[model samples]
Target: MAPENQPTTGPSTFIGENYHIWVIKIKAYLKALNLWEVIELGEPVVQPLRVNATLNEIKKYDELVTRSPRALTCRHSSLTNVMFTRIMTCEIAKKAWDKLKEEFEGTSRVKSVRFLALKREFELLKMKDSDSVKEYSSKLMENVNQIRILGETFPDQKVVEKILISLPDKFE
Candidate 1:
């Protein structure tokens, strides 16, 4: 018998909020199943059996074709009813992904505005002299994470510098 009580690694249902985090989690889930390529790149073309096609090539093509539906299913099952309706007719994983991205992540203009706001917040973060280092660092990291979630590049060095500059006078 298979092992019992094992926790599954399925993606959590995608509600309206936290779409960025859900995208990251769902990608991880798809990658674990070797189906990310199907979701990311869409259905692979099935070649007619021909003399020129190597066995490996045929096998790879078959695998992609077979896994495409499974990848779509994974994406479908991860959505809530309200979210599911948005992509109900999507026949491919990539289409479903794009639909969700467009709907929940917002349009490019909206995303650009949000990115700027988060960037500004991240830059303006300051550790108050009276605040404990732990509290201030926690707030700093939270802002950094929000910026990173928006697909911006915020390096650890920047965080370190922010920390150093914001150190209380006693720690200097």
Candidate 2:
């Protein structure tokens, strides 16, 4: 659902088009509010399911984690542990960081933090390192929180925000 006056077609609807509108859409979608609700409240509505679905698909291995706890704890722990470790290595982290960099270019780019921070965060989470995990998780979670705040502050970039808001917890 796009807003009444906002254009939906052409380049205006791109994921990184306008951060303000994207953020607004994110807040509404995060609250589980639909287009009808937004319209009723005199707010613009926009659907960002395209980007959301693509991003959600990034968790291709998620199904492997939802199996029985015993299976995961006993058999899969080592495997998953190793997988996440590999994902966090400098090589893999660099690739992912590059992809994100390409996705959000110009003013939308969030490449302020160093690549090592992301690698360390993923490593701590994978290893279940209590102290390290707490630290990295806090930092990563802070970034996510900032995104949410952006969604709240911007009224037009609702679609982009909604797509970001639907991001799933990696380990949950």
Candidate 3:
């Protein structure tokens, strides 16, 4: 019955890049608002087939069906125009979220390709001679985040070791 409040600062727009990060942020926002179950499990069907259903009871069931979708719409509205258009046709939030996931996140084949590409990038990562320690650290962490999102597990110690190895001899 109450309107869902908008997130004070929504995630970055869903451009061709940044789907992983954007979705993660969006999901967190939705979960915080208690709207994630609808997106993840869909709206539950409230059976109105009772032989003696009261009018108020039917209305209550109707509200339940619409509530999740409305919450999703509020959250989805934060997207950029192009991204909004992509999910505009979805009548409910679950469908919209799924459509976005399929479109940007892709299927297993695409995910595998992306995972391989991230792995390659991680392997080739290096601290350039001209790069500052901060810059190199940021680059390494960015790759680490992407790899993690793609379902790779890299222990903190291993990441630390990799960073140490990547540093120039001057840092030793």
Candidate 4:
């Protein structure tokens, strides 16, 4: 029985053709140009390093390479940090809020603002009558406002200011 026709599957081996040799030559060319790193798997497999990252994130990682937008290699940390920054921005938080609002509206629920106010009023009333309830309504209200601000889908000046203050200026 020919190996090609064998139904048994674990891992199968195959022979390479002249195209494989051509690919090796191209990889060599890329290496010479310092465009890519060629990882030689025992069977002549070439892995290109800089693949599958967003344009914006990649640009921040390496300004020179991003300016020309050439194929180059990157470490996983670089790619991960780019993705992390995009996710952490206030704009992403705002999208999440918008989606929540849409879902709440579809369910015929009272608006978030009205619901929050009513809840606060009830909590205050309970606090006045019952000492056991112990409601932190003001803190809750502040948190709600923060969430609404976060859901604006844009960067906030206050956030930028805070970040700037936290980091020491090397130049000054």
Model number with the top TM-score: 1
- Model 1 lDDT per residue over 1-172, tens place: 4245422666788977888898998888888778888877878887667778888889977786778888899998899998899999998888998888888778889878988998788778888878998999899898888878878898999899989998878897
Query: Candidate 3, which ten residues in sequence have the lowest lDDT sum?
Result: 1-10
Per-candidate TM-scores read 0.84, 0.17, 0.76, 0.18
Candidate 2 is scored at a TM of 0.17
- The TM-score, computed over Cα atoms with residue i paired to residue i, of candidate 1 is 0.84
Candidate 1: worst 10 consecutive residues by lDDT? 1-10
**By descending TM-score, how would the candidates be arranged?**
1, 3, 4, 2
Rate residue 20 of model 3 by lDDT: 82
Sliding window of 10 residues with minimal summed lDDT for model 4:
68-77
The residue ranges of model 1 lying beyond 4 angstroms of the native Cα positions read 1-8, 50-61
Q: Evaluate all candidate structures by whole-model CA lDDT and list the values in order.
A: 0.84, 0.36, 0.79, 0.35
* Deviation of model 2 at 21, angstroms: 18
Runs of candidate 2 exceeding 4 Å displacement:
1-131, 152-172
Task: Extract clashing residue pairs from model 1.
Answer: none
118: Cα error in model 3, Å: 1.2
Between candidates 2 and 3, name the one with more favorable TM-score: 3
lDDT tens readout by residue for model 2, 22-75: 434433432332222222233223333345565455453343222222221221
How are the candidates ranked when ordered by lDDT, highest leading?
1, 3, 2, 4
